[model samples]
Each structure stands twice: as C-alpha cells, then as structure tokens.
Target: MAEITAAAVKELRERSGAGMMDCKKALAENGGDTEAAMDWLRTKGLAAAAKKSSRTAAEGLVGVAVAGTKGVAVEVNSQTDFVAKNEIFQSFVRDVTALAMDVNDIDALKGATMPQGGSVEDVLTANIATIGENQVLRRMKRIEVAQGAVIPYVHNAAAPGMGKIGVLVALESDAGVDVLEPLGKQLAQHVAAAFPLALDETGLDQDILERERAIATEKAAESGKPADIIAKMVEGSVKKFAKENALLSQPIVHDGKTPVADVVAKAAKDAGASIKLVDYVRFQLGEGIEKEESDFAAEVAAAAGISKG
Candidate 1:
C-alpha cells in the first residue's frame, strides 16, 4: 500500500471532479498514482457522471411521503421530462423521498444510505452515468407536528405519491384522523391551487412587501391625493397584497370567500378539538431552474451546409 498525501487527493479531485473521500480512496487503491486514480474514478463512472453535472436539469418529479406525524417532500430533477417517467428514475425518487424523512436536509439525504447499498448520492451518480442524462437531487423538506397529523397531497401525479406538485400540510391538533384528514386534504388542495407565498403576512419576504409598497406608492402618487390620504391608500394596497399572497389570509379555494385561518378555526370548532395549522411545504417541479430553448433545425442546417431560412 502506498501513502496517499493531501496533494495527491487534491490533484485527483481536480482531475476527476470526485469528492475528497472518493479521491483519497481512489489514490489509496491506485498506489497513490494520479493517473491510476483517475482511471479508477472513470471506471467507477463517477468522473463520467460529474462531467455532465453542468447540464441544466429542469424536468422531474416532486415526491412526497408521510409517516404518521412527519412528512417529507423531495424534488429530483433530470435533463428531460421523459426520464421523469422512467421506472428507474421514479423508483429512485420514491425511495429518496421516504429516506428524506429520516434525514435533516438535502445534504444529509444525499449522504444517507439507501436500502440497496451505498449512499443516496452514489446511486444517483450511477443512475446518471447509465441513464445518460444530468440528474440533480435538488432539495428536500420535512414537516411535522407534535400532536397532530402531517398530510401529503400530490397534484398531477405520475404515480402514487409523486407528482408535478407535492404538498405537505402539518396540523397541530388532538382531533381524530377522521376530521384532520379531510380538512388537511382540502387545505393542501388549496395550497396547490393558490400558490401562496407564505403562511402569513409575517412569513412573507420583506423585500416582496417593500416592492409591493413601492409599486403601490407610485400608482397612488398619480392620483394627486393629499399626503396622509396617499399614505393610507398605499398602506391599504400593501395589506391587500399581503392578504392575497399569504396562505392564512387568502380565501379558501373551494368556497372562495372563507379565509384559511377562519376555515381552520371553524373545523376546530366542528371537531370539538383545538386544531392549529402548524406549517406547510409545497414543492413544484422545476420551479427555479432555467431551461434552454434550442433551435435544432438551424443547427442541423448549419452543420449540413444549407440555409434554414
């Protein structure tokens, strides 16, 4: 066995884009030879997988799972939507989502062990290499309530518990499942439909509030109203924006008039149990990633020495 120095591992990482531990192991297995270590990484498919890491992965599913009081949502992205329906890819997502309930966050979930073998990330890299598409374990979120239930809802479901929109609603109550489940399902549906920015005005981003304020002030200033009246008008506008964007203040999706907070209160009243909407999480597939718009015909024309136009 040869001694694996820090410099050797660093160089291997630079060459392979493999993690530090993997690079060190590669060096140790290859007798501290940089070239041999690089070979080992490529043979393991990790290097090949990392090479495709730069590709945009904006299509995939949002997987949701609930275990009693706790629920988790995980987004796994692939370069194309076709992979979203692939059994191998879908199985990985479902397993990862269930696994995410045991971990703290995305990093932990990736490092956590899967039932088959190796870390969640290891399987992911292997899948990427074999599947020949860039895949990303984008994010995971877990929600729980002490005395109540955490309900999961999947909209546009590709399978049982995974879909384009995954939502988890945590209710803190001693109410029976009979009452909590229906209420939670309704709220989760509303959450999917309404796309609330936050649970309440306080949870909303200050930057968002300020931006709305500025817009309202600009519009109101055009009215040429008195300063105090304009200030009041701006305040009202901002409040309306907050109410419209915050989940707790927004009108219920079904009836379209009752506020969410009031709906919860009414449910609690009817159930004869004190129910509180603790928290919720909504994960929409490819919510933030920018997708490329390519013109394949033009590229083919250019390559074939013909004009497309």
Candidate 2:
C-alpha cells in the first residue's frame, strides 16, 4: 500500500476543494495518485450534489452578457441570498452567462464545454457540492439583431452583469452601437420596470387573452346592459387590456405619455436610420418558481433527531 503523503492530500484538497479528511481518504483510496483521486472526489461530489437537489433554490442572481449585436441572460438560483453574494457562485454565474451567448437554449448551454475542462452542468454540480447548497441553472434567453445592437441591463447588480433582474433589448437597425446602444438601454430599462408580457398585442398569449375576455364579459354582464352593448363593451375592454400590457402599445416610462412604438420611431428619425424593436428577454430571479417554506425550529429539531410529541 502506498503511503498517503500530507503533500498529496493537500494538493488533492486544493484541486477538488473537498474537505481535508475527504481528500486524505481519496488519495489513500487511489494509491496516492492525484489524478485518480480527483475523479474519486468528483464522484463523491456528484453524490453530494444529488443529495442537495431537493432543497429550494429560489434565491440567486440573473446574469447577462452582450457581445456586439447579441446578448444572453441566465438565471442561477441558490438556496439562500447569501450564496448569491459568494464569489464562487457569482463567478460560476458569470462564466455560464458568457457561455450562454453562443447557445440558443438552456440545454445547449448546459452541454456546452467550459474553459475549466468540464460541461457547464458538470461545473454546476461541483459548485453545489463545494458550496453545500442547492443551486439550479433555472433558465436562459438569447436575443440578437442583424445590424443593430442587443443591449443588456442588470438591475440591482450584485456583480458586473448579474443581478436580481436582467433585461435584453434587441434593436434591429442600420445604425451603429453609438446610436442604438442608448436607445436600447432606455428600452431595456423600461422593460425591467414595466414588465410587459409581450412585444405587441399579437404576441400576447391566447390563454391570457381568453382569461381577460372572460373577466371582461363577467363585468359587462354586471352592468345589466343589452346583449349587443355588452358584447361591444367586452371587446373594448379586451382591446384596452392589450394596449396597456403590450410593450409597443404601452406608454413609455420617461414621459408616461408617448407609446413605446412612437419612442422607437422618434429615435429612428433622430438617428437617420430605421430601427425596429425586434425582440426582448426579461428574467427576474425565481419568477414563477414555487419556493419551499421551511420552519427554522422544525429544521433544527429534525437535524437533532428529535420528534414532536
């Protein structure tokens, strides 16, 4: 049996970020071979990560990255907000967001290889083990423009391009970044604040519209109007709802008067180039995710193997 040197254990600990005892055991189990010990440690980490996967991870950061005419946003969630501030978690989010710029979807981003010689998912699993908390690469979105700018904005940033809210504005224009960037930023900020559901009325979900129409119909019936008048009232209400919720039809955030469509048109006229608000992505951290509500006393009691009478 090869003697497990202290130097070998320390090296493995540094490489794998495992507990010192675990590193010593890994090195001992692998005949003092660092490479094999690394693989062993990663296998243990994978198990640890799986154990943590059941914990709720509704807190973390939304990361954004932009390169010229393309941008991507990624949301990474952790078990607590404190983990979001950790440098390891932040670096992982940043690196994953940078990788997301080239991928079209979340699956692709997960499968994409990282500079550190592993897939993004693999790195994420390792992080979960070292951080000792559940984390998830919740979602990713990408936007691009042929000739214009895809600007990115991070609201309440925890780091450079990661925050609680991430927004991307895809401006399809013939103008350069100098002109399109500022306009895109304004639009992105509006998106972050206004929370538009879609680009236009046509882009709104059919289900949501149906629900709105049903509500309008019910309200109109309460007025005790004639059937024909009620029909007209319901239609008017649906149209008004769409106008208020759709991005292009909604009023701009600046003056609260001009429509967003008119704002883009005015910017185009000023820049002497045609600009189109082609697409956008807004990812608020843990949006729509149901979090697990845990009681601290119960958790402590459970950990202590104590049962309530």
Candidate 3:
C-alpha cells in the first residue's frame, strides 16, 4: 500500500474541491492514487460542488434563532436569489442558525455535526452540488445574557426564522419574559430596520470614524473657511456621523422622534424593570460579498455548445 502524503492530499483537494479530510480519506481509500481519488470525489458529487465554489454567492438568507437567553444569527449566501426560496436551502439556513446558538464562530459551526448526519461543511457541499449553485456559509454570531431575553426578528422572511435580514437583541434585566420579550422584540425590529453599526457611539468602529473624519475634513476644507471654523465643522460632522450610526443614539424606528436610548429608558420606566440593552447583531445577506458579472447570452450559448456569429 502506498503512503499518502500531505502534498498528495492538498493536490486532490485542489483538483476536486472537496474538504481536506475528505481528500485525504479518498487518497487513502484509493491506494494514494490522485486520479482514483479524483474519481472517488466525482462519484460523490463533491468535485462538481468544488468547481462551483469559485462562483460568487451574493444572494441568500440570513436566519435568526433564539433559545431562552441565548440567540444567534447566520448568513448563508448563494449565487442566485431563486435558491433563497428553495425549501432545502431555507432548511439549511434555519438549522445552521439554531446550531450557531451553541457554537462560537463560523469555523466551529462548520465543524459541528448536524443532527441529520455529517458535518455542516459536508452538508453545505452536498447542497451546492444538488442545488446546482455555489453556496457559502458566510458568518454566524451568538449573543447571550445571564438573565433576560435574547429576542430575534427576521425581516421579509422567505421562511420561518430565515430572511434577507436577521437581528438579535440581547436585553439583560430582572424583568419577566412577559415584559422583556415584547420590549426585546421591538428593539430587534428596530435593529433590523435601522441597521445600527453598534449598540452605542463607543462601540462604533474606529476605522469607520476615521473614514468619516477624512471625508468631513475634505468637505470642510472645500468651504475655504477659517481653520477654527473648519475644525468645528469637521467635529460637528463626526459627532453627527456617530449619532446616526450608533443604535442608542439613532432615532427610534417606530416613533421617528425618540432616540433609542430614551425609548429603552421609557420602556424600563413603564414596565418597572431595569433593562439594559447588552448587545445586538444584525446580518444582511451578502452585505460585503462582491458579485461577479459575465455576458449572459454568450455564456448560455457556450454552455449549449454553440458558437456566436
């Protein structure tokens, strides 16, 4: 029996687009023959799945799941929005979001064994092949509180718990679920609509603030005003940017007048419960992934084995 080397496994993985472990197993089962290993992966449809992996997957669903005080949000991307409506694709997103409640990150979620069988990554590969499109298990975030409710909201749900946007609001308080759940849900809905960058101004990313400052400086400089006035203008611009992007400072989505901080405070006062908005996560499907463009007619003709005149 020939000994399988790391290089051999890597080559098979590159050639077949199967997981590293799968490639190694295939090589071992095929007596370290790369050609036989490729054939093995092809027989399982993994090769085809791998081939599709290169395609950009910029449309799909964001799913949210909550269990008691813990909640999670996940994004799964596909090459086309049509797959977002597929029952199988929807199920995958729902299941994965639930799985994320226990896992810490995307890698852990992928490594986790699904209830049905096989790892999450295995199931994703199978889905890619069977669904006939590139798919990505892009990201997952989990938020939990020691006490209180972690409420979930899905906007424009394609299916239960799955949608184009998923938001989870973690409220830590001594309040009963009867009081906390509704408040949390309201905040979750606000989060989905407002798309806050952070829970407060302090939580906003420094890089984002720096970018805003640079732009404000450029705009202020164009006014040809005195340096002190320009400085004041830039300061005002940065502060406004922070207020608009931060969750607590942003105006409440429902009321359009009360700031979120005041809304939470008022809700706490009304309910007679001390509620703290601990954290939040909002996932918009394919928010950052870039989609690829190609000539559709020429590609269709090429696929049909026809030459363009």
Candidate 4:
C-alpha cells in the first residue's frame, strides 16, 4: 500500500472540497493515488455534495420531538424549499431531533451514535450522498421536566409534526402530566407565533435594553422637556417595551385577557398543584441568515439581449 500522508489529504481536500477526515479516508482507501481518490469521492457523491455546500441553505425545516419528560428541537437546512419537503430529509430531521432529546450537549449530540446504524457523522455523509443536496444539522436544544412534562409546537409544514418554527416548553410541577401537557403545548405555540425576545423581563438581553434606552433618550431629548420629565418618559417607555417583548410579561394567547405570569399562577390554582415555568427554547428557521436579493428585471433583460432602459 502507498503512504497516505497529511500532504496527500490536503491536496485531495483542495481538489474536492471535502472535509479533512473524509479526504484522508478516501486517499487511504484508494491506495494514496490522488486520481483514484478523486474518483472515489465523486463516485460516493461527496464531491458533488461538497460543491453545493457554499450555496445558501436558508430554506429548510425546524423539527421537534418530545419523549416523556424531555423534548428537543432541531433545524436542518437545505439549499431549496423543494428539498425541504422531501420525505427522506424530513425523516432524517425527525430522527436527529429525537437524538437531541437524548443528548443535552450539542457536540455530544453530533457525535452520538445514530439511531439507524452508524455514528451521527456517518449518517450525515450517507444522507448527503442520497439526498443530492447539501444538508446541515444546524442546531439542537434539549428541554427537561423535573416533575411535569416538556411540550412542543411546530408552525407551517415541513413534515407530519414539524415545520418552519419549533418551540419547547418545560413545566416543572407535581400536577398530572395529562393536564399540564396540553396547556404547555398551547404556550409553546404562542411563543412560536409571538416571537418573544426573552422568557420574562429579567431574561431580556442587556444590549437590547441599552438600545431601547438610547432610542427613548433621543426621542425625549427632541421634545425639549425638563430633565426629570425626560428621564421618567424614557423609563416608562423602556418598561413598556420590555413587557411587550418578553414572553411571561405578555398577555396569554389562550385567554388574551391576562399576562402569562398570571396565567401560570391560574394554571397552578386550577390544577391543584404548584406549576413553575422553568425554561423554554424556540427555534425559527433561517432567523439570522442574510438572504441575497437578485435584481430580477436586470437579469431578465440581460438574458434577452436588451440594454437597460
């Protein structure tokens, strides 16, 4: 057998755009012949998959799975919406979500033994080959309940029980799981729709608070009001902003007449048990990716051999 060195792997990776380990393995399996290694990668469809990796995969699904007292949410992205609707892709995402429920740490989840047959990485590689598109297992979060249950909600439709947005809510209490699960799911749906910035006032990001304060200060200064009055106005606006954008401080969606904190209190009273809203996780598909905007008219004219008007 020929020697498979780091230099050989690097050369193959630069040619194929495959991951380092994958390139090394390809070279080793092909007897350290660069041409054979490239052929091997192309034969496995890995090179084609790697070529598409740089494409923006902002369109995909948010998957959720709840197992007993624990729940997990996952986002798997693809280059096109059509691929997002693929049954195989949806199944892969569902299985990955369940894996997330079993493993709390993200790195551990990535390396966790896949439910199918091999390691998680191996499964991803196989999916890339089978799916004919670049795919990513982007994020996962686990929610657990000490006493009650963790509930899930998904918006839109990418799968049977998954969608574009997924939320997980953990309710900790001694109440019957049968009673709390429905209410928890409703709250999770609310969170997905409302897009709350924080769980409550206390959980609001400090930088967001500062930005609001600055905006309020600028607006108040323009009024030429007295210093004390300006200060009071800024404080009032800040308080209102915090309340409106935070989950627990906002009105409950089910009733729309009471704040979420108060709704939790009422739930506890009605359930004949003390239920605490411990924590929650919400994942919106493509929340932060910068989408590219194409100039459609210009492209059309160019294709038709016409000069710009």
Best by lDDT, which number?
A: 1
lDDT tens digits, residue span 1-309, model 3: 789988778767876778999998889889998766775675554664121122233899998889999998899998888988899998888888878888899999999988899999999999999999989998889999999889988887888888887889999988898888888888888988777888899998897787667767866787899999999999998898799888999898898988988888988899898999989998887775656657799999999999999
Itemize residue pairs with steric clashes in candidate 2. none
Candidate 4 per-residue lDDT, tens place, 110-206, comes to: 7988777787767877888998888877888887876788888887665666888888898998898777888897788788766778888999989
In the range 1-309, model 2's lDDT, one tens digit per residue, is 899977678656665668899988888889888766665665454212110111222899999999988899999999899999999999999999999988889999999998888999999999999999999998998888778889999888888999998999999999877888899899999998888889999998897788667757866787899999999998997898788889999898988999999999999999899999999998888876766666788899999999865
**What total of clashing residue pairs does each candidate reach?**
0, 0, 0, 0
Each model's lDDT: 0.87, 0.85, 0.84, 0.79
Return model 2's CA RMSD, one decimal: 18.5
lDDT of model 2 at residue 287? 77
Off by over 4 Å in 1: 1-57, 307-309
Selected candidate, larger TM-score, 3 vs 4: 3
**Inter-residue clash pairs, candidate 1:** none
TM-score of every candidate: 0.80, 0.78, 0.78, 0.76
* TM-score result, candidate 3: 0.78
- Over 160-229, each residue of candidate 1 has an lDDT whose tens digit, in order, gives 9998899999999999999999999999999988888899989988977876677677667878899999
- In lDDT terms, how accurate is model 2? 0.85
Mark the 10 consecutive residues where model 2 has the least summed lDDT: 46-55
- For candidate 3, the per-residue lDDT at 143 reads 92
lDDT against true structure, model 4: 0.79
Which scores higher on TM-score, 1 or 3? Answer: 1
